[model samples]
Target: MIKVLIADDQELIRQSLQIVLNSRQDMTVTDVAADGQEVIRCVRKNVPDVILMDVRMPKMDGVQCTKIIKESYPQIKIIILTTFDDDEYVYNALKYGASGYMLKGVSMDELVGAITTVYNGWAMINPDIAAKVLRFFSQMAQADDTISVREKDMEELTRTEWKIIAQVEKGASNKEIAKNLNLSEGTVRNYLSTILNKLDLRDRTQLAIWAVQTNVRKRVET
Candidate 1:
């Protein structure tokens, strides 16, 4: 079973998440925290596979907590769950190695899928925030050194893999990519896995960033 820790300052939100997530057959809510400090303490006591972390909290906040947790325990996947999609928060959370970023308004199914995706070593970002994320990386890619390094790393991808990466750079889901490429969903997933392996990326989030940094999407368009 995938163990999850829900961290939100609001009691109602925390309790609601715990109840909903705990109802899943494949997951269990190991604990809940009202703030970032408590989240760290709980993680140290009983490490969870995934953490649903709210961006705003009483102390430390989710961004700082993510940095500290990822620094100390890189294996644990963290999903930033928040009502706000502030650009700084999104950029900082991703910079700090968060596995996913999702809004609280998402359905329970999406939440579960995000958790599962992260646990399985893939990244998940809400579609609404995807554009901001892409733009964030695009701006950062203006650095010549970073672009050169990412371009060098991207050379290993095959033509088909490049197509897949282009789709990912657009924030297309696996299903959408499969439909667009006229391949089965399993095939798309397999290609994504191979792409991640070839690029030495941890998950799709890194792959997307690399795609933007290396101009894979622009090349595909042109």
Candidate 2:
């Protein structure tokens, strides 16, 4: 079964999530936290497979909590659950290694599906949020001249790494890349870390942006 941790400040929200998730045959709520600090504590104790995290929390906040979780427990996937859809929050959450971004108002069915989706090595986002993410990327691409790609770093990637980079450039998350390449998700994540380190990029978001700026994906076509 997929072990999950629900972290939110509101009692109602936590109870609602626990109810929705516990009803699933393939998943269970192992723990719940009222705030970000409690989230870290629960994680250290339960070591859940996935964490449903709220962005705004008293004491530690979800963004910082996510960063710490990703750094310390790299295997644990996190889905950002929030009522706010601000660009900065979304971008920073992605930057910090969130596997999914979903608004809190999503239906219980959708939430269950999203948790399953992330567990199976895929990224999930609310459809409406995805549209916003696309628009954000489009605008970033239009302002391209401002973002620079280092030529020396670009030259350092191997052919396989380049192939992986092309997938990431297409906004394919680690899971999507694994599916497309017929590789394991762990392998995709390893490749992603190598790519990030080699390219001196921060995360998949930066890697995607750099891919567009450098036209790395074009190399695949030609």
Candidate 3:
């Protein structure tokens, strides 16, 4: 079962998430916290597999909480739940190793799917905010022209892997990539894993940034 910790200042939101998540047979709401400090306490007592973190909580905010938790318990996956307007917070959360980001208005089904996806070691970004994330990374990549792509790294990837990277740069999900490439989802995931390892990237977010930096997507498109 995937253990979950919900951290939100709003009691209604916390209780609602607890009820909805606990109803799932595959997941359990292990604990709830009203602030970042309590979240740290709860985590120390019983580490959860996933944390649904609210961005604007009193005391310490979710971004700082994410940084702290990930620094100590790197295995714990965190999904930042916030409004779309909190673009800076979302970017910082991702930089601090948050595994996923979801808008607070996401449906229970989408939340559950995101939780499962992150628990399985994949990153998830809500579609609505994906473009913003891409833009943020693209700008960052442009600012850091020193970030070089070694010729050897380009030569190391197979043609199929390059295609997968192109799809990822376009913000295609694993399922979408699989369908587009006529491959199974599992195969696509495996390819992603291999690609990350070969490129020394931490996750798909970094890979996407690298793709933009290297003009891999543009090259493939043309």
**Tens digit of lDDT per residue, candidate 1, span 78-196?**
99987655667867788789989898889999999999999998889898778878888787677542522355656777888889999998988898899999999999999999887
- In order, the Cα lDDT scores of the candidates are 0.87, 0.80, 0.89
Number of the candidate with higher lDDT, 1 or 3: 3
Cα lDDT tens digits, model 3, 1-222, are: 999999999999999999999898999998999999999999999899999999998899999999999999999999999897888898888878898989988899999999999998889988777878878778777684324556787789998999999998877888889999999999999999999888777788778778877778777768
**Candidate 2 residue-wise lDDT at 175:** 68
Rank by TM-score (best first): 1, 3, 2
- lDDT of candidate model 2 versus the reference: 0.80
TM-score of each candidate structure, all chains considered together: 0.93, 0.67, 0.92
Q: How well is each residue in 42-119 modelled by candidate 2, as lDDT tens digits? A: 998999999999889999989999999999998888999876556677667776788788888888888888888777
Count of clashing residue pairs in every prediction: 0, 0, 0
Model 3 TM-score, all chains together: 0.92
Any idea how many clashes model 2 has? 0
Which 10-residue span in candidate 2 carries the lowest summed lDDT?
Answer: 138-147
Ranking by lDDT: 3, 1, 2
